[model samples]
Target chain A: MKKWVPTVIFLAVAVVLIVLAIVFLPVSKSVWVWIAALLTLAIFSILYRDNPIYRIAEHIFVGLSLGYGLAMIWHLALWQIALRPLFVEGRFILIIPIAIGLLYFTRLIPKVSWLVRIPISIALGLGSGIAIPLIFQATIFEQTKASLVLPEMFAPGNPWPGIWAIILIIGIVTTLAYFFFSRKEKSVLSPVSKVGIIFIMLGFGATFGLTVMSRVSLLIGRVQFLLREWLGIIAQ
Target chain B: MKRRIPLTLTLVLGIVMMIQFFIPHQFSQDFKNTALEWLRVIGGFAFIIGLASFITHHYTKIKHKKEGWAYSPIALGALVVMAVVGLIGRSPNMNWIPVTVQGQQISVFTYLFSNFFTHMMIPLGATMFSVLAFYIASAAYRSFRAKSLVSILLLVAAFVIMLAIIFYNVLPLGDLGEWLLSVPNMAAKRGILLGASLGGIATSLKIILGIERGYLGGTK
Candidate 1:
């Protein structure tokens, strides 16, 4: 009875909300909106406590995403790349890809599972090879080039640009120096590393604030949907 | 033999792909395109393995009657329903269970998919993430204590950023917050990115040269 109390109370509140929504919502009502609101509430019930309703919603989400991904891959990849060319266009060369793709299913059989490594190796190799130069060009080279502040930044009337450029250069140097594990923290590197810690903290703080704001906006969206769209309590 | 063949394939393919990036010839582009197409097909089949693992895991849970096993059936049922509806609805000529709503023709499969995705998936996804707002607040309260100078700096920076975002018009700290982000934050981020990229390049080189044989299955 103790366990059932919360569930019963939740159901009663949900039923009352649904009834209110049905009665007060605009005449041009979307059943989808009602279902969405209920699902949102069902998921939010996890905040109160772990219950069967939240578990079911979570599991259903997992399964549905998997199914949706499969359907998209079937239509987008297999049909377009392999089947259409093999059957409709008489391109027998597609047999190579189809065979390679079929090797992926060999993972299901214990003895032949080693065959799965063939495709995996190819994919990983290609990915690694392609990423090496790109990462160097984009992240390392471009970022270092951008960090070099020219003296022209200080030539103009507006001095904030030059000031910010100096701060950026210092920040980048100190942050990089903090990660230098080759040498011990001597007197010279000690203060620089401390400065690096400050910049790192500031960066993380900004990231956390942005993340919280984003999550809060999502909450606000659900609240707005519940109030204005579902309950008609607020004017649109 | 199994491991050697795969390792050789990795080395050869990695070298070819790397070289192809430098070559702007038509043939090189065509080769890359064909290889990518093959990769896509293989990727699709890879998901089948994932789906199989999912089903097996859930089936075992339900079979053992584990705690909350009742929800397993719901999940499996949803998976089957969504898959069937999505696959059938994607076809252009799917005429089964046709219905006209307000003079527009639509299939039952399409309607089911729309309802399932918009009502079930979207709301669940949004609400799941929104729940993090409460957790973030709790975490911030616990971690924002100013015990040391570094901690105090972190707390102050976070407070300034949050306040600036909420009351940018009412307050004058927004410009300072923006400057902090664009200058020091960006610099630190770029430094981290440069370090990570260098590490990634090293790992990639190791993999391509067959020094990292981790991806290969266990030896017989």
Candidate 2:
């Protein structure tokens, strides 16, 4: 009886919402718009408690995601990735990746599952081979180069500004040294490393603040739903 | 068949996604785009699944009269009410309900999602996250000992970064803050980024190769 009370009320309100949506929104817009709002709250409820309702919602989400993924793979990969080049462009070389991707389906077979690894290996080897150098160039080389090399003083006559540049260079060097786990620091090098540590904390704090903001945004959404949607005190 | 097929397909698609990045052929490019689209669709569907799970889980708890089971009704009530409004308020004909007036077509849902979801959830999420500040401050207060070399380094860095950002608007202080962010700060961040990228690459490779099967459900 206690259970029925909420379920019944929920069903009643849901019916009203459905009726209102169908009558008002464009057919395409209505279903998705409400579904998106409801699901967002449902996910957020995980923070309060873990229950069967959340699990059911979770599984349905998984199945839907999987199905959607399958559809896109068909539309994009089978047609665009593998088939188009093979037939339309006559790019026969495309067969290699096509074959490799197809090999992934081998896991369905009991004895031949191991065959999937060959293609997987080629993907990893090629991906890393390209990625490593690109990462080094963009992040390591570019960032360090900018930091180490300064512009010629804007005012050549001003010594005070160049003094700042010298200090900046010193700071950058000592900070880098602070990260070295293996090095034994003697004397002033120790203090320089100390300054480096403070900079790292500030970066972490800013990122944390941004993450908090996104979460707060999600909570605000649910509260608004309870007041405006269920109560209906607020007019549209 | 289900298990094998899913496993194989996951492996194949996963590998293709990784390799496509390097190869740059039209096929690879298409694969990447398709994979991204597929992920989005899957993510959307996952949202519905989440809703369903919420209802089922809470309903069961309420049924069993478990501790805190009373709250289940509130959750189930919320889910059903929202789902119905979403569905019924979506049709074109004279429809069972006339939620909208002539030119200003509106429904409870439009009211809910637009007004409620955005204004409420977003801010709540941000505030919940802000609670981290108290936790961080308390943790630092208790744990920030200046005992050793590494600890000292950490303490000083923490102090400078905090002081620089907080006192940034002042004359020489602002200048110090800018220098801190641009030079020493940037250098340390880069070093951290370098190490992290190396780790990410290794993990991505492992996952693509199926060597990292933990994500696939453990030691079976």
TM per candidate comes to 0.94, 0.52
Query: How much lDDT does candidate 1 score?
Result: 0.84
What are the per-model numbers of colliding residue pairs? Answer: 0, 63
Candidate 2 Cα RMSD (Å): 10.4
Task: Report the number of backbone clashes for model 2.
Answer: 63
| lDDT (C-alpha, whole model) for all candidates | 0.84, 0.52
Q: DockQ scores for all the models shown?
A: 0.75, 0.10
- Model 2 misplaced stretches (Cα beyond 4 Å): A1-236, B1-11, B22-28, B46-53, B80-104, B145-167
Q: Output the lDDT of residue B126, model 1.
A: 92
**Best of the candidates, TM-score:** 1
Per-residue lDDT of model 1, residues A75-188, tens digit only:
899988899889999999999878887898888789988999998888888878778777877788888888887888887688878889889988888888887777675868
TM-score of chain A of each: 0.90, 0.66
Fraction of the true interface contacts (Cα pairs closer than 8 Å across chains) found in each model: 0.75, 0.10
